[model samples]
Target: MMYDQLKVLEKTIIDIKKKYQLVNDELNSLKQKPNTDPKELAALKTQLSNYRNEHDSAKKQLGDLDKRYQNLAEAHHMIGEEQDKLHKQLADLQRKNSELQQHNDQLKQQNHDIKQQNHDLQEKNQLAAERTQVVLKRLTRIDQMEG
Candidate 1:
């Protein structure tokens, strides 16, 4: 929208300048003429002055519009950079999360292996206790018989 406005202002300034030039040429021509009316010359001078003022105003407006456009462009570029940074951070976090998940799975497998080993050891301990009791009973029987 601002660009469109700038274009319009530029066109206006160009038109004003052309009109000013034409009036100036006509005034110069009248000055060279032997029979020129004072009223007409004065009117042309006034019109030329008005056109100059309008041209100046348009130029200032165009300058302001250009400044505003530059500011907006800078802001948009910064936002794009910030968005890229955020995406990179998100990717890094996702990669880290995946690594942690893999480590957790490894720990779970290790825990399961340890539990299985503990269960097997308990069964062996139980069998060993049973065998020890059987040997003690036999020893007692022999001792009583000898007595």
Candidate 2:
């Protein structure tokens, strides 16, 4: 029975000490609260509002810069596509130029062949005229002998 009474007394002492600590903490908080002046609080509020405006302005400027960067990226992509198109056109033109060169070479060869044929025909015509002259001379000699 005595032991139980001692336990109850010890518990009461612990609870009282906890209550005293809580009251002291509350008193200290109240003392500090009174030291914060209204003017200082207003000044802090104004500074916070200015910082908020500056932050918002910076965020808007960043958004505009991002938009400009995206536009530049799109323009660069379009330029790349145009460059590819020009390259393909250049290749096609090169192919056409080679084909034209081949056709010109064939025409030159045909002209050379025609000139050779004309030379051969002129030589044959000269030989036939010489044979006719020889035959006429022989006929004139025979007539003179018969007379």
Candidate 3:
């Protein structure tokens, strides 16, 4: 699960970098293009300004995603430690000469809850990835048309 999140985060970072570069290159090309139509030039400039804003937004999101990646890594490490502790506790409980049904059930429930949370996180991450891909595709289409 953490690995999937890492992949998604890395992909997002790459996409944002690509977008930034594409926008910068387009702006440079606009600068080099011969001045023939003032109206068209103004429109292109407006479009470039919007892309610049979007590029800045993507850059900010990339930074935020990096922080989230770090947070997820830390959470995974903590979850591992917690699982280890729970396993040890379960072992000790099993060694006791008493009914262990209730304790075992509680542990099982905790495990189930953790699994559910991880599943939900994975789904959300996947949805976010889908949305990012759609946006990237749209941007590529626009770039192609403009070029």
Best by lDDT: 3
TM-score of model 2 (CA atoms): 0.60
How big is the positional error of residue 23 in model 1, measured in Å on the Cα after superposition? 12
lDDT for each residue of candidate 3 in 1-147, tens digit (9 for 90 to 100): 889989998988888888888889988998898988989988998998899789878978988998999999999999999999999999888777345776788889999999999999999999999999999999999999999
Highest TM-score model number: 1
Taken over the whole model, the C-alpha lDDT of each candidate is 0.79, 0.71, 0.90
On residues 34-122, what C-alpha lDDT tens digit does candidate 2 reach at each position? 44778876775675566556555655655655565566667777988999999999999999999999999999999999989989988
Show how many residue pairs clash in every candidate, following the order shown.
0, 0, 0
TM-score, per-candidate, Cα-based: 0.67, 0.60, 0.54
The order by descending TM-score is 1, 2, 3
* Model 2 CA RMSD to the hidden true structure, in angstroms: 24.7
The regions of model 1 sitting more than 4 angstroms off are: 1-44
Ranked candidates (lDDT, high to low): 3, 1, 2
Q: Give the lowest summed-lDDT range of ten residues in model 2.
A: 1-10
User: Candidate 3: lDDT of 145?
Assistant: 100
